[model samples]
Target: MKKFSYFLAVMFLFTAFAPAAMASAPEKSNKEDKELTPEQEERLEEIKSRVDEIKSMDFSSMSKAEIKDVKKELRGINKETKAMGQGVYLSVGAIIIILLILILLT
Candidate 1:
């Protein structure tokens, strides 16, 4: 139990400090600051409109299949949005595994 607590403590510290460390890295040129191009920006606006339409929908009146289709569409839009963004995104599971590896190595 004590060892588990220590592991959690280390993991918490790592998760808290990791973002700070990454943020402190030297900035690049202004080009790197621009996340998306004009075409991508237009597409993003379309996506936002579609999402808003979905939100304004009456889901309760829809059939199960229709609901399923809406969910699938949302998932596709989510993937596309993520693909359009530029960054190294780490999932929670990946972060935990990385922290474990660092802990074991130390």
Candidate 2:
């Protein structure tokens, strides 16, 4: 009976600590924040601000050509953001898949 009780306590401790251990594991980079060089960070911020500016503009009052130009700039920003995310996204996806497999197997 004593041995069984000790085993139960050990199991309870293991279960409690399992999630903390997983949470503390080094996370896969899911964004370009830490990866960006100083110049790239400045450029990204500039592009983000430009995108916000475009969004806040009075599109209804703009001329057709101006709207088209803004649309082009928006598309360019989308491409740049996608490029920045490419590396981080794959790793994150892989981590998720591995976790799912572990869950299912256990």
Measure candidate 2: CA RMSD.
12.6
- Stretches > 4 Å off in candidate 1: 1-11, 20-32, 86-106
lDDT of 2 at 70: 84
lDDT of model 2 at position 18: 68
For model 2, the stretches where C-alpha displacement exceeds 4 angstroms are 1-34, 86-106
Reference-based TM-score of each model: 0.57, 0.48
Q: Cα lDDT of all candidates, in order?
A: 0.83, 0.73
Tens digit per residue, CA lDDT, model 1, 1-106: 8998997888788777877876798866544456788999899999999999999999999999999999999989989987776334775547798877897899
Instruction: In model 1, state the lDDT of residue 86.
Output: 38
* Global lDDT of model 2: 0.73
Q: Candidate 1's error at 4, in angstroms?
A: 9.1
Any idea how many clashes model 1 has? 0
